[model samples]
Target: MALEYSDNMPHDEDDASDASSDVTELDANDFPDHFSEREGRLFHSHGSLPYPLPVDSPEQARLNNLHRILRDIVELHYLGPVAEVLCDVRGRQKRVLDLCTGTGSWPMDMARLFPGVKIYGLDIVPIATRRPERHVQFEIHDVTRRSRWNDGAMDFVHARSIDLAVTDYPKLLQEAARLLRPGGLFFSGEIGRYVDFAHGFSSDPAHQAPRAQRFFQVVNHSLQLRHLAPIADKIPSFIQLSRQFTVPTIQTFHIPIGDWHPNTVMRRIGKMYLNALKDFAESLKPMLRETGMTQHDIDNYVNGFIHDIEHVRGLVGVYHTAWARKL
Candidate 1:
């Protein structure tokens, strides 16, 4: 049966033209395994979820409905530029690995763009894509586990938002360096703790704006207790660890909430961010219980997020993408 989609669904072109984005075209023999591209969507089976879930959830259901629409937005908005970095074909040879593949959008798009390079998508959970690109493969493996790749096996290792499941990021970096073939690159993109936006929302006294402040604080507090390094502060050190890796380059972007911008479309995009967060708050009921927080406390925390998302203007959250190559 053909998959049904909603009227509000976002498309791959809703954002920018990635094809026009800068790129270095390369040959197919750039990696060990060579696979060509096919037309129709690659992933089937699992529906897409509203947000990528951590492996701890152990929820393996296909997000076919949610993923088909949202994955494109994430790809264009978040992963596109980084994909370009990893897909660069000007070098000697390129073998790419995308960790925390989500719905496998990043790797799939990269493979489609560079049909010659071999790209691997790694995630703890399975993805829905079935694109017969011999150049790409999806593997179910934990990166936090000791890497199985021999020393210097890949040209690039990329991870995005995998910190939600990672307890020790620096250790993960050390592992990524070990897996990189000499002169390979290691890149990571991470969501900053929402609290960083607290100050930005404070200037505006919108209805839900104040609430976004508290909700993010609670989430940030919980994360800090878990010992995840603040995303911004750690990127530099992560790149500096080894003699083979060069200084990391960092790029930061904002995911604006509900169209606080002057433009109508931007307002709509902002609204979606707010809505996504509200829906996300509900899962906290069970999540809080696992954390040993009282239900009342969880309710207050989640409610704050909902109110701000709905009422705040010019409210935004940020994420960082940093990459470095081995010398």
Candidate 2:
């Protein structure tokens, strides 16, 4: 899928037939192994990821679905002068790192794409695959803390959808700056909490989600309460503020929230995004419970959110991807 895929027929990459987005409905009293049940939802008891979502199989499905959606939107595993940087260099070892690598799918794909490159994926929980390619290393580490990699040791660093776990973008940028060599690139992509009818992302209420603006606000509030960053819209600014990189190139992807789009490919992306939204609403359970929401009321809110967003027309999420070269 490319920028010209607006009216194109849906391909396998853009379709949900892969079943990665087919989240299994769980029984009321069921709990998976090594997972803790909180307010009728499952959660990871491992190192703090500051995530309210379940770390179970279903949650992994949502993550995988989202990965595909974003890739289809951008038409690349990454954005930037990545080709020149990752292009095969004679007699030199190139390295890549993925932070908060849920399922380790990104790095895995990158390894296959660049067989000669060494890739490392770090996450709070173990990656889905116990055994990966020889040059690819998967490890358990909380990205919110410092990484073990030495200074200027990486050729590229990738962080996607980590706002749920990281509170400070500037601090994270500093870490990326430390890890990258001169001319190494840093790439980041994140979704904003606010959805609007127009691409301007206007502050005017008329341009916002017709029936779900309050929902976005409440979600942002909950994230702030946990000292988590809900939006990475200002990451390019943070990168510039750190003075560790050249001017960043920012790319925006208008992800539809429902099957309301006229374009066939966009509508397909919308349906997939809608599925992710439902699961995300479900993932809010544990956090909402901590905020004193009763299980009954929480369930009602989740159901209502799903209904509102599904019917809302022209509701589009703004996703920002920024990439820059280290100074």
Candidate 3:
């Protein structure tokens, strides 16, 4: 079930915004006027001070690659391919809204694949560098606030990797439901946990000194300090209990962090995951320092952890994909 591009499809002129005009490139200075910098990381002025992640070029590149990796791993646009999942819907024009759309990779790909769908990508900053397709648009908007989209106006609402961006999961889900038409699809994908192992990554759980797990613990603590909740693992329960959505489904993928897997494809994915983890370590250093660790200690720990993971192998992390339809 492949999605065919509809070149003759009519465009939605009303939903287009001028936000992309200034987004020709991802220069730090080009970021919204409200964005502030601290320790070389960008933070939204409207958010709960000190956004957890960096919006710099390297981070944006990491996110763009990650979006591609996830799309390949999940192997679908929605619960199924766009054609199979949305075949029943009766409409010549479909609309999609990606909340907290980093780099706008997913929406841009969707626009190319499903040319009839009007794709809107919203984020706190305009980090997306790609020129918008005729049907795609990027906008600066915070996902936590009430959206300007009319009720039941969207056919599909997609959010991914927003665990750090969202403060209230339930409220966001509610907002997603409101924006979706009855029977419309809502897809949420997140990293449920930082790192895991089939048996356990640590050979000696108790005796092992502060290392990889400790690094994740400190990172989680830093996020907690910023009022961000680690709720990705619980999204399924949150959706099932909401009562506004039906047929909730969750698909979990365990990506190896290093080239430990025997299979060729798994090894390739493992290497990619390792590279991503390295980027994470760099991005997370300032935040980990906030957790009472000295700068010297933070450097030693992060370097040691990266070295261990690179050599040891078998470290894995869980990525969760949760989808449901509005009732």
* lDDT on C-alpha atoms for all candidate structures: 0.55, 0.74, 0.72
Ranking by TM-score: 3, 2, 1
- Could you tell which candidate, 1 or 3, scores higher by lDDT? 3
Give the best candidate by lDDT: 2
Q: Which of candidates 1 and 2 is the stronger one according to lDDT?
A: 2
Candidate 2, residues 1-327: lDDT per residue as tens digits? 000001122323212111112112234332232257665655665534566677777788999999988988887898988878888877667888898887877888888889888887777655345456666766556676777666877899999999887877788889889989899999999988776664543445434443466666767788888787565678888888899999999988889888888889889999999999888887777788788877887776677667667876777778898999999
Output the lDDT of residue 187, model 3. Answer: 86
Task: Point out where model 2 deviates above 4 Å.
Answer: 1-35, 47-49, 198-210
lDDT of prediction 3: 0.72
Error of 3 at 106 (Å): 0.6
Report each candidate's C-alpha RMSD, comma-separated, in the order given: 12.2, 10.5, 5.8
Q: TM-score of the candidate numbered 1?
A: 0.68
TM-score of 3: 0.85
RMSD from true fold, candidate 2: 10.5
